[model samples]
Target: MEKLRVSDACIGCGLCVAQNEKYFEFNDEGFSKVKQEDVEENDKEELLNIVESCPAQAITIEEEK
Candidate 1:
């Protein structure tokens, strides 16, 4: 499984959540948050889109062990 992480750079733009609601969500302060560490492999592309869509460059994907 892989986990999506939101860095400190997040400006709370909400773009990541907007791109893929299944994987990403917004925290109370409006920053991007990963709802799950495990996602279908086919959804990777959409996750990529979420990463790119983040205006604050706060999103990242990493393998989970």
Candidate 2:
């Protein structure tokens, strides 16, 4: 399975959150965060696009072992 992650490098630009509220949100410090790690099959493509559009390059997709 693949998991979504928001790294510490996030700049709190709100791009990901704005693109998709289902999996992305703001943290206490105002940085971007992944609301859930598991990515649904139907949402993968949209999430991938959001990841690529992230200016901070903080969002990523990782393979789980």
Candidate 3:
């Protein structure tokens, strides 16, 4: 499983949560956060799509060892 990370650059645009609520949510500070980091292989494509859709480019997928 890979780890999904949201950087501090997030502008709280809510695109991530709007696209996939299962994997993302807003924190108290209103920044988009990765609710779950252990991504399954089947969901990688959708996750990548969300990453690309981020207007602030705050999302990233970290390769697992």
Which regions of candidate 1 deviate over 4 angstroms?
none
1-65 per-residue lDDT for model 3 (tens digits): 68899999999989999998888999999988989888888999999998899888999999887
Off by over 4 Å in 2: none
User: How would you encode candidate 1's per-residue C-alpha lDDT over 1-65 as one tens digit per residue?
Assistant: 77778888988777777767887788888777778767679998888877777777778888876
lDDT of 2 by residue, 1-65 (tens): 79999999998999899988899989899998889889999999999999899998888999986
For all predicted structures, in order, the TM-scores are 0.82, 0.94, 0.92
- For candidate 2, what is the lDDT? 0.91
Quote model 2's TM-score.
0.94
What lDDT is obtained when candidate 1 is compared to the true structure?
0.79
What do the candidate models score in CA lDDT, each in turn? 0.79, 0.91, 0.91
C-alpha RMSD in Å of predicted model 1 compared with the true structure? 1.4
Clash pairs for candidate 1: none
| Model 1 steric clash total | 0
Backbone clash pairs for candidate 3 read none
